[model samples]
Target: MTFTLVVPDLRFSRQAGFNPLTEMALPGLASLLGRADRNQLGGQSAEQWLRGHFKAESAGAAALSRLVDLPAAAAGHWLRADPVHLRADRDRALLFDAGLFDISAAEAEQLLSALNSLYAADGFEFVMATPQRWYVRLPQAPDFHTTPLSVVTGQDIHPHLPGGPTALQWHRFLNEVQMLLYGHAVNDAREQAGKPPVNSVWLWGEGPEPTGLAKPCRSVRADDAQVQGLALAAGLPFRALPPAFDASGADGELVLLDTLGRSARQGDLYAWRAELERLEAAWFQPLLAAWRAGSLPRVQMILPGDEATLAASLGPAERWKIWRRPARLEECLVMGS
Candidate 1:
């Protein structure tokens, strides 16, 4: 599994406030809400108590009022009960979970549909990489996206979140996936720290197949520095590329973003499977080489699929950097697999 991510700084953080509602979707709420200090209900009932608090908001409460739409209406009460610091603008938003899962193509399509409808009003640009992966351009920077130990999971999301399969379950599931993709050493770090997997949020981001890795591949085309910085922090080496463009007879500059793999949406597993194979083979060699050399250096590949899988290979401590630039794009064929 692999994906892409957009890394923003603090300026981006101020643009978007913390979205705690998504946090509630995770498994353990007691530690997050500081319920161990509260004398009311023991920490065990924190989830239920938190939900109740958000449900009791007065009609037309301040900025919080906007969050209540029948589904989230219940949360209003919780906000009223346990008032915490909140700001109008958010901090940062990242595009992730791209091509990092094993979801079927049809399932990916349904998930994307739900995300498009749910966040349509936000005016974020949606870039489709494959049927399952995508990138969202947000009006505000979301603070939650940059967490070191975050989990993003999406199944068919037409009905409601945290329904039968809770967000925490998805978080745990993704962590397991991360372990499978990155290696058990990644999970070991979290366990040693005595902290539950860190960044756990259940919701839809683009289609289910590509998940969140698609867009970062393009964004990395331009901003390799930030991506490289993240990779270095994760104790990985960053690989540099030559150029991505050609002067030969070409059909204009098919801006990589516009040429996203194929027309296949999340619903088309057939196309996704073929593309995935092509991508893995292209990227695995370099990554495997890096691993063998004991330098986990981030390598740039021409295929978005390669970038997605490479991203998935990173654990909470690992970061994959994608950059765009003629200098950054190179001919994978020249490597001579």
Candidate 2:
């Protein structure tokens, strides 16, 4: 069985006097790094890579995620309208991910109700799949493209709004929604409670579902909604990533281990190092043992960051090449950066 491990931000920003490998020993990962073949998979965020893997047409996060509920026959008929998460900064609005917000389901419901009331006449409706994940359905799909939210976190959103033929209409709609939400009672209550208000919605992922998508792996194990959604859409078996790896039973499975992305994005090198050590003990160590014991046939590590991805292919023979000394994790990060 082939195991594909997707590790986001495996590389960390360099510090004046910091060495990750010195703090934690990751022999397994080091061995793989030492002998495995490396290849560059272009420059794209992890989300963009997944979209390409699933053959998704719409670049919107909503478009790819909405496929989980859409039937195959009606795939191309409807466009996915995902909610944009915005933070009300001092003077300008900041675009960020939903994970950074503290929105509750009840609060989302209240805010969405007001939005739906105003947008219903425009043939737009909002649905909150989760407090963090919101959606909107368009009567007729708009002809526009949007930047992924991952790329714009912590930056002003005015320059990154949707663009295309219907850009004017979409911008107007966003202004109207922001105005309505700004004055809603929910925002007032949130302010009183010392919470960030849901003041605006970013509409994006406006395109039809992809066609002729093929499953890349036999089975998928992941914690991400997009991975699970892609598995569902492709008619493949999927399970949540188990806390431990059972090398004896892992065959023909894809495992997505997302432990480092958050810290890397936040530029918290200390936290990034801590998480890397934990992953080293839990994953890399055991997997290396399995590969050395001939229990595992092949393992592929896909490390994705904001700009590029590094793919490493490892096998039993590669691990035994003691001449290829293990390099520090910092070295890998520096090369990638």
Candidate 3:
């Protein structure tokens, strides 16, 4: 069988003052690295890499919404609004993703209702696919560019806001939405309950629906909406990632493992280490055993980051190379860094 494992944020920031691998022991990961053939897969954000895998130029709000069976407009552009925290300085506002703000479906509905009523006259409507994932359809595509949310979390957003002919209009609408949300009763209740109020929305992934996505693998196993959406759009079978590799299944399966990304983004090294160890035990160890037993023909582990992707392809023959000693997780991290 052929299995492709995609792990996002597997590499830690070199500037974090401490090495991430030093905090954990990853025997299975180290063993895989020791025997596999390594290559660089170029540099790009996780979203960009995943988009290319599906042969999509842009797999943003509209493309993802399409996969979830949402209605689309002929000339509409995706106006994805994510709840965020805006810290205002003397001259600018620094935006931070409100990662801890857990909104319920009821709360999301209430906020979207207010937003829809306020922007309906402007030919904008809000659609909530989930409490945290919301989309808006615009009458015309905006002549502007937006930075992906992954690139701007916990950073200043003023420089990354939309830019071009329709930038001013989009900016103005964002400000209006902020003011409206700031005064809404829902936010008032949240603040009273000591929860971070749904203060503002970050508009991004602006584009029309995607077309002609490709199916690179026979089956897909992942929890990411983008992967699942691409699979659905391509009419491919998809399943949630299993707890362990099942070599008894058919060949050619694409598995996406994303536990590393969240903690890395949050700068939680402790959590990152714990998750890595868990992955080693749950996935890497089993796969390694299968390869040794000749039950699995090939396994490819792909580590994708904002800068670059590190890929290791191993087969039974490669695993038998005892001359190559298992490298520490730190050594592999340096190659990626």
Candidate 4:
């Protein structure tokens, strides 16, 4: 059987001082890295790569995620209208995604209620899937495209906001929402308690019902709503990522490991090290043992980073490649590019 592991922000380096990422004692990863046939895919996002794998290049994240997240959102053109925080930095406004902050169910309810009431007559409805994920269902899908919330996180959002012909119109919508959410009771309470305000919504991932999606793997193991949505759209079985790597049997399975992303992006050195260690202990070590014992045949690793994506293929035959040089973990590693 064939197994594939997809991880984001794995190929990365520290900004300064000791680079714990390269120093991890991942014997399995090191062995595979040395033996696997490696290649780089420049300028491609891990999300986009998943879309390509599932042959859903035409699909939008909103439509894909909605299939799993907002199932009641039937018969509608949808867009991911996620809550965010815009902070005034030195020269530009940085977009802080919902993951960077916290919002309780009560806060989400209060915030969405005010928003829904204000826009009830505007030909759309605001639906909250989770505290962080919100959606806008429309009668017809818009023609413009939008940046994903992940891509916009911790970056200047001036150029990433709604673009295309509807730029002015959506810009106005953003301004109006900011005005409405400014100093609301929720924000007031949040500021009083020392938390970031739920001040704005980042509009992105617009989509019409994603069709013609093909299942590329036997099953999908992922924590991402968008990935699960894609699997569901393609009629593939889906499961959440377990604590460790156990294929538990699939002819070919697609597993997404993205937990390392948050700490890596935040540049939390010790946290990053700890998460990597967790992966090494839980996944890589066991995987190597199984593969060496011939329980698994072929393995594929997809490592996505800011500058490029790396693909490494491994097989039993690779064990015989004694002449292969030791792999450099930092070869494709680049952080915060």
Q: Against the unseen true structure, what C-alpha lDDT does each candidate score?
A: 0.26, 0.70, 0.76, 0.82
True-vs-predicted CA distance for residue 259, candidate 1, Å:
26
Model 3 C-alpha lDDT per residue in residues 1-337, reported as the tens digit of each score: 5677888888654665667676576778888877899887777766676678788766564567446535443445666677776767678777766454578889888989999999899898888877877777777766788887767876777888888888898899888989989999998998899887887888887665667889777888887666677778777888877777666563588888887777776778788888888889988888888877777788888887555678889887786688987766675665445
Residue-level lDDT of model 2, residues 1-337, one tens digit each, is 6777777767544566665556577777887776777776776666666667667645445555675534332333233333445666787778756666577888889888888888789677677777877777777756887765666766888888888888888898888887888898988987899876777766655555445667777888887777777777777788888776767457667787876767765667688788888888888889877776777778888877655677888876786677887755566654344
**lDDT (tens digit, per residue) of candidate 4 on 255-317:** 999988788657687897898889988988787777767777888889886667888888878
Write candidate 1's Cα lDDT for 13-63 as tens digits. 111433212222211111111111111112211112211222321211212
User: In model 2, what lDDT does residue 318 have?
Assistant: 81
Clashes (backbone N, CA, C under 3 Å), per candidate, total: 58, 2, 0, 0
Instruction: Give the C-alpha miss distance for residue 312 in model 2, angstroms.
Output: 0.6
Displacement of the residue 51 alpha carbon in candidate 3, Å:
1.8
Looking at model 3, residue 183 earns an lDDT score of: 93
The alpha-carbon RMSD values of the candidates against the true structure, listed in the order shown, are: 23.3, 3.1, 2.4, 2.1
Comparing candidate 2 with candidate 4, which one achieves the higher TM-score? 4
TM per prediction: 0.20, 0.86, 0.91, 0.94
Candidate 2 vs candidate 4: the lDDT winner is 4
User: Model 3, stretches more than 4 Å misplaced?
Assistant: 59-61, 69-75, 88-92, 243-250, 335-337
**Cα error, candidate 2, residue 224 (Å):** 2.0
